[model samples]
Target: MQVISVNVGRPRPNPGKGADLTGIDKRPVNGAVAVVVPGPKGTGEVGLVGDRVYDVKHHGGTDQAVYAYAREDLDSWEADLGRSLGSGAFGENLTTAGVDVNRALIGERWQIGPDVVLEVSSPRIPCGTFQGWLQQQGWIKRFTRAALPGAYLRVIVPGQLRATDPIQILHRPDHEVTVELAFRALTLEPELLPQLSAAEALPEEARKRALRRSSTG
Candidate 1:
């Protein structure tokens, strides 16, 4: 697999969800972009050098430092929406080709280019800001139902990466908690939540939710 484009957010006014600004307007950038581990959540810090999230409470942090989506998935969405969807249109930092991002297991490690290493941590959860950005009615429901929420990654080895960088699957955790499975469990199917406990690399918030569901069940 390879990276189709490296995107960075361009801050824009967001009247939706009461956030003054949103970084959902990501555009492809040329040249190498630094990737680093961000601090905790609620700081708006992301892995990319110039990109950050405005919805601090729900986005960013080390667990969600980078978001990646497959070009194939975007193409599917384009066909469904009858519009052109380019790289970063979904607020993802990396648009990849030949990669089944949703099928990637939590804690899977990928080596991008010759340096950067990122680990799958969670699945991107659609929010009000995303729905507003797309201007599609019931977009949140549509995206959730699709269960192609993409993958959120944490920087394992900080370095530089750019468009067309080859991606190598360095490691795959011995678990079945893929990004799609996590999204389904977190959103529509609470019964699957108990299975997420097998993925120890899941973010603290998601892990706790899974734990709660397991205890209750």
Candidate 2:
């Protein structure tokens, strides 16, 4: 697969979630961008340089560092929604072409460009902020039901990433915990949390959350 666009965001006013500042207003950048592993959530940092998120409690961490969405999926949404959705429209840092991002396995490693290696960590869970940005009623429920939540990634090897850079699969963990599966486990299907244990490479917080759910159930 290839990177179609590299997007970055700046903090801006967003009244949708009752916040004065939000980073959901991302736009595609023309050149290469540096990708690095940031500190944990609430640290006010992100994987891509110049990107930031307002909801510190729920966003911007190593595990959820780089968000990626497929160009194919965006096209599908455009057809369904009857509007054009550009790259970074969903606040993803990477807009990928010809990649089944939602089907990517948890812990799967992709060698982006020549040096950057990104590991799949979790699924992008829709929230009130996202819904408000889209201004669509029932959007959160619709996105969840669609089961096409994009993949969240962690920087395994930091490097510069540019639009049209090649992406190679460097590793695929032997597990059934795909991004779709993880999304379901974290959202619609609590019973599936136990199944996530197979993906031993999941981020500690995600693994702990799944294990806790499994244990509780």
lDDT of 2 by residue, 1-217 (tens): 9999999987777746745689988899998899988999888788998897878888888888899999999999999888889999998999999889999999999999989999998899998878988888999999999999999999989989999999999988887789999899889887888899888878787789878877887
Candidate 2 yields a Cα-based lDDT of 0.89
* Positional deviation of residue 157's Cα in model 1 after best superposition, in angstroms: 0.2
What's the TM-score of each model vs. the native? 0.98, 0.96
Clashing pairs in 2: none
**What's model 2's lDDT at 21?**
87
Off by over 4 Å in 2: none
Off by over 4 Å in 1: none
lDDT of each: 0.95, 0.89
Error of 1 at 164 (Å): 0.5
Worst 10 residues of 1 by lDDT: 11-20
